[model samples]
Target: MASPAAPQPGATDPTLIRNFCIIAHIDHGKSTLADRMLQHTGVVDDRAMRAQYLDRMDIERERGITIKSQAVRVPFTKQNGDDAGTTYILNLIDTPGHVDFTYEVSRSLAACEGAILLVDAAQGIEAQTLANLYLALEADLHVIPVLNKIDLPSAQPDKFAEELAHLVGCEPEDVLRVSAKTGEGVEAVLDAVVEQVDPPVGVADTSARAMIFDSVYDTYRGVVTYVRVVDGHLSHRDKIKMMSTGAVHEMLEVGVISPEPKKADRIGVGEVGYLITGVKEVRQSRVGDTVTSANKPATDPLGGYRHPNPMVFAGLYPMDGDDYPTLREALDKLQLNDAALQYEPETSGALGFGFRCGFLGLLHMEIVRERLEREFNLDLISTTPNVVYRVDMEDGSEHVVTNPSEYPTGKIAAVHEPVVRATVLTPTDYIGPVMDLCQTRRGTLLGMDYLSSDRVEIRYTLPLAEIVFDFFDALKSRTKGYASLDYEATGEQSADLVKVDILLQGDPVDAFSAIVHRDNAYSYGVALAQKLKELIPRQQFEVPIQAAIGARVIARETIRAIRKDVLAKCYGGDISRKRKLLEKQKEGKKRMKMVGRVEVPQEAFVAALSTGDSGGEKAKK
Candidate 1:
């Protein structure tokens, strides 16, 4: 017997469309699961399918990480039910698993009615697993707990299923077990999604309204926005207005990405798709903006997303000063794609013209810098990352400092630093080292719990500045790559902090300055001074590198001058003649030291600031 025809790419019926996203910890096989769904739904054929098909960037593919959220539409036909012949269009948004990209996950969750909480059967529940689960729950998304990687020899499906069930408050049988790698039981996951998750509800007769979940800048097509139709219908050639910005433009095209972009006549209520308005400026088409008909707009816009708070700040400067404008333009384009990235123009004495950019975390900053270098072909240098601090001066004045250079010298009152509530999950054996690592970073223990006999969860409140450095790298190394961490900013507290400045040849270089806790200040200064002594080249005259707080020097290193042997030409000369030659050389050296200026090479700054050992990691020693 012949089979029935599959559902079309665009399903106008609200009941027939199911919008959902996959959330998981890093390397838990989210993209792999997405690839399987696209394959099983027949949206992608065998010859064209590949691993991590949803991750579009070359960097993402190379690093085996998902930095951006990708939305795709797939059609699935029911196999065994009273309505077995019926088909449904499933909109799957694949999100990044890293803690830095939580903003992306939150945005994706807002558009979906359900989320697939994916966990590795071998690793079980991780820090990000709990973090993302809380986010999904807060969004009121119907979460389907699924244990992946069951095909692996290390798979412990039964044990993890109970843990997952306990976490989600569901029975073990309700927790679906699937191997996203081998495509086993993937159909059951899709079936469970359709049966358990609620379909989107929107009014078809009302004025057009859609939520702009995400957007990207295309070099040829300008801005391509991904939207979820919440009410009414949006068709081609309809003039649209942005409810937040009050900007209007004609919709040039409307389409759905069924593994690829295919043109459609209209995107109706409860559908997820892309829209093209030919808007060139990235800032104009903001993420979380409401899109509505220009002639007949909705009464009120949908509740837009909260602006992301950047916890880490760093300065990005072009190696070639002429590329400053190019860097600005690149950041603008990148900001459209990554709304969480924030930047503003700032001039540095050492690095020249650049922008002090804010990111959610270190990974986000690294990805942004890499994207600028690769995509825009601009060589950039980033200063050491720091957290924002609120400084109260003696004269009853306040200053917010992001860079160490901005820290006030006359701070006579209190300095408040940002703190985070950190959560860590690890095996029972590594609990001691984990706690020790957190304590060394000046963390206060909040709580601890045993997930099972073998796994445990630990919580702590740590300063943001501490974790922004090498905390994650340290945690992973200490635990032998078995621990996972997730943290949330928990307001600020007044702390005894001091700004340590690096001075070369009696002149302070603002790029190497850092704000550190009072206790770590001396070590930080010593480490920075030692690092500079190695990185800076020898000059004609001796150069002194000093780390100081205000006028008091805490650490110092001398870069010895390259001395030319003035007596090298003297062979069996008289004592007075040899003495005269040495005196002449000494006088010349003194004059050179008085008149000459030591030039700190650009590579030295980059090397000293970029290395992990140059920061708090070495201060720990």
Candidate 2:
């Protein structure tokens, strides 16, 4: 077993520092490659090593995906080349590959000088691979294309290498091929990183200025902010000010993660490390905020990241009313780490206290809810997810509705819903099925192109609401899991959308309300009404579940009443006696039906809101 090397003298020298991130499609061997790099650099010993070494969260480990962008300072000593025997500080950020975590990828790109565009040798280039490459190009980072999984029997490294080279505008021989599984040619990756990636440039003598790329809340240490020192240096015990919030805190600890936290006296220019300020409040340490010395602040804070626009919105209510405050606190902590999460206090008539939270997508919403339950230990019920909509009033005012209950009541001129331009890469045989799926979801064909002889790229403009749920699942099923999709918001368009409200026993259940397109309203109502009937328990009297739009009822289902055995006493008596007992029972049942309220249980809401039904019928009002 071996220990990681300590920071050598001149380790923070701008010329010796290389900041780069691995960007690729999901499961394209980014994390595995990162592990090999760590092993090759001797940052982790055999005893401390595990798969997906950069992913720390239990949920991430269980799902085998990179949800967060993890940074590690690997000290790679060049073995062969003109720079042989030279140790370079490599700040490697492992970014998420899912479309939902695009913001994480963007943030990581901003801090890096170059990116390793990884592609699966067997799977070739997928939709997310192109998406990430464009993002890196937009960030103006130097890109080194690499192909992983070359050892697999199905891998066509030569074919994919040509594809990668063509995509990157490089020669076919320029693409690096490696098997991350067997750790072959991984050293080549490190050597190429040092030779190709541009060194970070910054002035070390100026006032301290660092960009907070990420942050997390720890119960013991409070907020731990991860920053990339852009200019000057940050020293331990220095009072640092958050340039955005104008709040100041003393840096209790400054350290670098050499796959493990190692204390550092100062993080100089071109270095990446974490800073603990012991500030309990999460809002004070925002991602993208600039950290500067309080006494001699930099004249200008670096350009910060754009706020992520939440594409999906949902309501999260604690199952127990008493857990509301705990849920709020938990969300605050999560928001500090996931800058894309947005939430506000909201109250539902049926579900009681909760927050109206916005997420980047359906997966993002699911992950946030899981974190609330697993990490915070709170029982939560999340309403069906929906996209934000804008309602134009006849009075010339407009309102934005994230929740169904917030839909305008007055005369509405029109409702504009968010739209996304989706790109799908699939085999030529699956193009017809893919097109059919998109068309059924109210998609308009944008264009199509032949990426290769057998690979085709299809583009469509679709309503965000249509693809938020089940779309990906349906696509995978239709394509036999051979298609990859990526989408981005493409503004909004006025549409014939109506709010569908679900009423139980003539009272509206705010938790089950959703806004749907006019053409699909009847079907959505019918399906939701049917789903509620199966979920809601039978009451003393018959309960009628109705789905309505405004004052018009579109669909209804009835839950039969629990019969009382009033006739049991007269079982052996005369016919008149039995008739009288039945009549009395009917009268009593009618009276109870008139006065009784349907006490829908919390479990009913949770079950109905869950994605158990067709995505089209999700309660997304």
Candidate 3:
């Protein structure tokens, strides 16, 4: 017996079409599943399809994570003869699995009507899985759970399915067990997707209404807004007005997100398309906004169009001063694609020229920092991440401070700091260690429960300021890197924390500083002063390092003076190299922010001061 005929193209039947996003915890086979889907759809021939076909960036491929959400249209043929083998457009959006980019995942889900929740058979559901599942449900998308990586030796599909049913409130039969690696049960998932997910609701209308889901900057073409036509049909050369800005521009190109960019003269309702207007920047083409005809307007704009705000901040500086312009250009290019990233030119007396960059979270900061170094081939010196704090002055004034240097002192006032609702999933055996680690980081346990026989989920209300720098690393270390953590910003609360400034020489290093707990101030200051002593090169005079608690010295160190004079002796023969070296040293000295006559290294501005020693001293006191 021969296999059934594949579904044909242009199947208008709703049962044939499927629009879904594949969401998973990091390394749980999302991209691999996407590859299989593309291959099964025959979009790319077997020879052409690569591992992570959707991840175009080297960093994404190397890191084994999808940093950005990508959309691809695949045409699949149903095996059933109900519609005599019809072709359907399977619009698949692959979203980032990391918690830091959960906001991006949420936005991408708004464009889709269904989600394929992928879980590793061995690991079952993780903290991020629960988080993304909740987001999908909140968006009202039909969730189809899939057990991925069943080919692994430790696969436990049945247990995972049971957990999925219990955790997500889904039926056990509804969870499709599949190995994306071996192509087993993948067709069942596709079939379930077509059966469960609804198609575009209404017919295409010529009326002006389009929802911009995402936008990207094209060097030659300009800003290309990726939009889904909800209530109208848009065509090339059509003049459209941005509902948010009221700016009108003629469409230069209309295309779908596919290989070679399939050009469409027009896109109908429920179809996703990319519109290239002459607009040079993507900031104006805000995500979640509406695009309408200049003359004909829609009744109302789409909901959920709030702008993303950055919660964490750090200073980004070039290792070499000459690379400052290159770093700035790279940042501009990066911001063209990411609307949430914010930055401003900041000069640190010790670090020279740098930018104070804002990110959604710590993961977002790491991705950006990695991308800068890998994509732009530039070495960067990054400061510790800090949370923005809200301060209420006694004069009835409110101020937002990102760096510790800007924090108010000697003022009678109230201060508010950000906090997060954090969730951690780890092995049951590691709970004790994890709890101990959380307490040290100022995390308050709100709740805990057994997620499974061996795994437990712990909930904590943590100060965002505490976890902004190294909480994730600490948690991973404590749990032996088996814990999966997710967090969302809850709100601001009153706190007695103050910015403890680390002064190198006599001037303050803005980037190496942070807003710290007043109780732990002296220790943090001392550690930082010690770190600077190790990082900065010795000069002619001994440089004094001090951590001051509001002008009172609490922790102090000193860099011993240099005694070598080899350059001074080589006055004639090695004069050129010596002069060049001296000039380079002078340039380096210029880069260091001078406190009085002492020069401090840029690294001193961002290194965390060790508080352990200071804490011990305090205990003795």
Candidate 4:
């Protein structure tokens, strides 16, 4: 999205430019640290600022977390330091700290030359800190250790910094201490960034080339892509073509964020900015794709671009059947901003038409669903979140299953479920309970180590399905909120799985079909039958809800028939007459519905699969 022309007061010089991103564990104050740096550089007015100012979405602020990476250009004028008399163009990328958005960190790091590794002094080194530090190293970015929250009552910067230094292979004195809340020592972070973080260097070329790190869609202005110019320059006159998709468009505007999009004459080499292509289709300007001048195209696309792989799948159906077109439009617009989100139209016999969407993780799935309902104002019903399963059939072929209906029938070979390597950081006191919980979920202990005197790091290999539901919540509850987890899919392994079907009355309902482990099938089926019984209202006839595997029924429950007011019309005529009429009505009920279809409420279907707070609801019965 572009507005009237306005550029920040500064000279875009490559030699004085620093492109870097801030990385931290959740709740460790990365965004607050970013706000302090912005104030120090005079990019954001302190009086007009809000807390966690970098988070743009309402959900982000409400949750007190950064869900997306925000970019801004800061002009740091060093007056009394080693770099005095120099005004550097610092491009700061505020990255999300949660494990679900690790790919976001990777994308931001691809466009940066260095990173600020922020850690909490009170909490010390946690799970995400180690995970993110390794990601930065993998990207070969320079890392400057910054210890934050030194002002907290429990702050112990010396100890945490020492531990951090040991992990990064540096001296303890190299770590910088800062208090983001009080804006203390934040300037030191800026100075250290300029002095320690090297300036960005671009390929020597006159042909225009830029990398699209992220993008967002605007209804009025079309797709606005965020890009970092790697070589040459991008201006209003250039004809741009995406290297990956090959869709060409004329550049309408080029500008810098300065937090908000501001127009500029041009974005030159080694400069971070935005590109307004007026390209409505988001697929044309995908993240990690190279945007090059169509007339003078670059011989090769930019390196280090990997296609995003979504880890979770769920079916999102509109509450009303006629809203299918509206849902499609909303998804099209939503996917423009989120390149990692994948969606395709799917049909379910019970739920009708909907889309089977893929997400990076559970949080990603939640955010997408919330946005669809709140932002797009569409009522949606989501199925149970499932990991992609691999089915090895007896025909000597392998197939992937995204929906329960896709599960192969009469399989003779084997079924393989996804598995993940989970890392848990918790206090030493809670180690026993944590390990016990993991083992019960069919987890295999990989290793464990003490990070500090009272904190321990535990690693385990768990079935991806086990953790996809409420594993994080259970871990936190067991550790009394002292635990943080980070996980990555390792691969797939042999699993004994069966498709449990839910039959209403006598007919099977496809919406309640789930592929569960064989050992848990009976209990799971019983739970499903009980839950469905509660959700389905009593009709004229007793509705039999049964959970079955193959041809045999495993568990069954029934909703008792509602006693109609047949005696109301009797008017006290005769005791024998009333008895005969009641008997006739009871016999009529048996033949009236003849195992007809049963209707279930949306809430019942959701509560049956929802995790976290309502996990105990299904097992209650």
Where is model 4 poorest over a 10-residue stretch in terms of lDDT? 612-621
Q: Runs in model 3 with CA error above 4 Å?
A: 1-16, 82-84, 318-332, 373-379, 564-596, 601-621
Clash count, one per candidate: 0, 3, 12, 0
Which tens-of-lDDT digit does each residue in 81-140 have in candidate 2?
554367788999999988999999999999999999999999999999999999999999
For model 4, residues 1-621, the per-residue Cα lDDT tens digits are 112222342246677788999998888889999888877777677677788888989988877878889999878876555543567788999998877788888899999999999999998888889999999999999999989999999999999999899888899999999999998998788888889888878754578778888889887888999998888887776788888878889989888888788888788878889988888876677788888899999888888467778888999998889989989988988887777889999998878899999998878888888889988899888888888888888899888999888877775598888898999999999999999999989999999998888889999999988887878777877887778888888888988888999888778887788889999899989987887777777887888888999889999998998899888877856699999989999889878778455667777767665544322211110
Query: All models: lDDT?
Result: 0.90, 0.90, 0.77, 0.84
Residue 269, candidate 2: C-alpha displacement in angstroms: 0.7
TM-score of each: 0.96, 0.97, 0.88, 0.95
Off by over 4 Å in 1: 1-11, 81-84, 611-621
Clashing pairs in 2: 404-621, 513-621, 514-621
Reference-based lDDT, residue 446, model 1: 99
lDDT of 3 by residue, 151-209 (tens): 89999888889999887787887788998898898888888877788886644545668
Better of 3 and 4 by lDDT: 4
Model 2's alpha-carbon lDDT is 0.90
Task: Give the local distance difference test score of model 1.
Answer: 0.90
